[model samples]
Target: MTIQLKQEIDKVYEEDYLLWLEQTAEQLRQKDIENLDWEHLIDEIEDLGKAQKNAVETYLRQLLKHLLLYQYWTQEKDYCADGWAEEIDNFRNELEILLRSKTLYNYSASILEATYQKARRSAFKKTKLDIFPSECPYTLEQVLDLDYLPE
Candidate 1:
């Protein structure tokens, strides 16, 4: 069921994903570190709830990768770009630390799971009624056939 939901969600936002990657990559090439506002980013992330929030966080991680790469490129004094390699490594480690310590996606998984479960149950109930062809509107089976699997 999760697989089907993931597929549907991907289908719904396919364009957004592509655009986000392109923009992030462009920001990297332009060395637009000043425009990579983390506070606004965090606010945008916070506005999302459940699976959408998780998805956004995953996207943000990709953006962070590009940002770190850009940081490395910009930190080069003579284009030698030596010390920045280590700095990039440290930056990635720091991101990991922040993600772990800050509970960035802590609420997202549970909220999404609960919402998904509710929707799945509602869908399954509707399908079961359709399959049985019962005259009574609310005659649910003791054991559902489980036809409305996620994927």
Candidate 2:
């Protein structure tokens, strides 16, 4: 692509992203490789992968937070156990949807420890309880299983 045309495409990406996306799709479908916004396209594709991984990490952390509450927060167990369990199921379902990709599933497993630490901190902040484990107590399988609830 000429420098002028490339600059115009990049400007469109910044000024009107939806228009740029539509135009980019048309360019790809037409196989007009010469005019394709290669730089922005590559960045967007990479961002898509990262977005999937980030979503899985987020859901896993939420699941861990609720699991800790349900399993260890004795003071409010009678009042909050069922709600926390429900949130766990919801997060599990969301994680399962995002984890359909094997890459994302493995990514979730890899980030488990780090995500759990964040969850533990969040739980402590909410309940002012320091009783939760320092490390993750549940494995990836247990967290993903719909039927599994930590006792």
Candidate 3:
């Protein structure tokens, strides 16, 4: 199953992998690290998590493997140009550590916000409940407004 999922991801993002690598390297070259939007990357990671939640660990391992390969490929050329190799190596090490620590499921607020926006868009397309939903089964405000029963 893990192998099959890896294959699927490889097929789906084969082009994206290269694009991300190029974009990442370019961002590094600009030395605008502080402005790099890790949130967008985290959202992609979260999307991967959603796709493979059933096999989170396996998916993360495969992702880490692919990321390391990407780093290697990107760094292999001009390996000695302005410490790029070291930076790529550091990224590879960090990816490995993240995979080993099973931290892929952890997402930042921006990631959640992006994901939620996507979900909301989908839900809106499906039904009007997205705009006006029914009342809650246990409204916290209502309960809080009521007097408590004797303990």
Q: In TM-score terms, which candidate is top?
A: 2
- Report model 1's TM-score to 2 decimal places: 0.20
Q: Scored by Cα lDDT, where does model 3 land?
A: 0.40
Residues 1-151, candidate 3: write the lDDT tens digits: 3567446545544557776656656777998666444555577768776654434333323322222232333333344323533443443344344434334434321133333344344434534333412221222222122221111
In model 2, the clashing pairs are none
Give the Å shift of residue 113 in candidate 3. Answer: 30
For residues 35-129, write the lDDT of model 2, one tens digit per residue: 88988999999999888888888889899999999999999999999999999999999988888989888898889999999999999999997
Tens-place lDDT digits, model 1, residues 1-151 = 3567546534534557565546545766899765443343455466654445555344333323332333323333346334434443453444344345334434323343343334334433533422211121211120111221111
Q: Select the stronger candidate by lDDT from 1 and 3.
A: 3
Worst 10 residues of 2 by lDDT: 49-58
Q: Where does candidate 3 have its weakest 10-residue lDDT segment?
A: 142-151
lDDT of each: 0.39, 0.92, 0.40
Off by over 4 Å in 2: none
Ranking by TM-score: 2, 3, 1
Residue pair clashes in candidate 3 = none
**RMSD from true fold, candidate 3:** 24.0
Which segments of candidate 3 are over 4 A away from where they belong?
Answer: 1-17, 25-31, 56-151
lDDT of 2: 0.92
